[model samples]
Target: MAIRIKGYKWEFNLIESPEINAWCMPGGKVAVYTGILKITKDDAGLATVMGHEIAHAIAQHSAERASQMTVAQVGGGLAGAAVGNKSESTQAIVNQLYGIGAQGLYVLPNSRKQELEADKMGLSFMAMAGYNPQNAVGFWQRMAAASEGAQKPPVFLSTHPTDESRIAQNPRDLPEAMKYYKK
Candidate 1:
């Protein structure tokens, strides 16, 4: 629960986008969209969204993802090298196919794991930041409702957990988050 955020030069900005979205890039750069403000009606709701995005930066999810991609690229190179004696077409095909398989087998699954990790970390962070973590549930529930009827890729092929899964996880993470909440 002790997260040291003092060293980074953090930048938080409200972007003038109509999309209900938020993101945190590496090195503590964060942006919250104006459209999401409708859902996040107050400070606690806003905290719920910001805490989750901040958790991604705090945990270095972007770095981790880049590392994973680099590894997958290296793996493809190795695979192509193993077929060095083959024709140029054969090597290209091997590398290309390997990239696809690696994305499904390695990259996307890790991305989903990061999302879940951020969800739990976000809860703890919001609580520690003096906002009740319980608000996260309502926030995510609203997100789910907001996205209802939107078509989505199947879970296995997606980079994030389904809304149902995220909503389900919020309550399970609350008890741990409450440990960080004071008053």
Candidate 2:
């Protein structure tokens, strides 16, 4: 059956892996790693993750990220030239500064925003698809617990929102998402 989200054709792939991860590529291609099923626990939890991934595609997050990276690269080059074109130390500093600045100023924040948007969109999608939107909060909480003690970059340098932040927003978003729930 054709899905409610229109325009692009959707394809799902199941991959065997031990890493708890999933992703949606541009043009509605999606992949779910077997390892994530542990956290998903049930069909509702699975719907939560699936909706989130699909929402990323619906929002065109991949294209926006690529465009942002291109801009950041060009801006970094210009900033480097402005600082110093000659000294090796200056070049190194510029590179480091660019990495910090790009991530902190643009990339990380944009990524977090996209994540939140996807969460909101996903909540609605799952609710409309006959899954309880409230389950999303529990799913994220489980995901957070699963990743505890694992090495992770600091929030400023990371792309996705921190688990605490993601889970915290769910209750706030639940009311709206519930409106779309059919059963």
Top of the candidates by TM-score: 2
Score each candidate by Cα lDDT.
0.89, 0.92
What is the Cα-based lDDT of residue 117 in candidate 1? Answer: 92
Per-residue accuracy of model 2 over 1-183 as CA lDDT, tens digit each: 245346687899999999899999988999999999999999999999999999999888999999999999999888888877568888888889888889899988999999999999999999999999999999999999999999999899888899999999989999999999998
Off by over 4 Å in 1: 1-6
Error of 2 at 163 (Å): 1.2
TM-score for each prediction? 0.91, 0.92
lDDT of each residue in 118-182, candidate 1, tens digit only: 99998888899899999888888888888889998888789999898898998999999999999
What's the CA error at residue 69 for candidate 2, in Å?
0.6
Ten-residue region with minimum lDDT total, candidate 1? 1-10
Clashes per candidate, residues 3 or more apart or on different chains = 0, 0
Superposed Cα deviation of residue 61, candidate 1 (Å) = 1.2
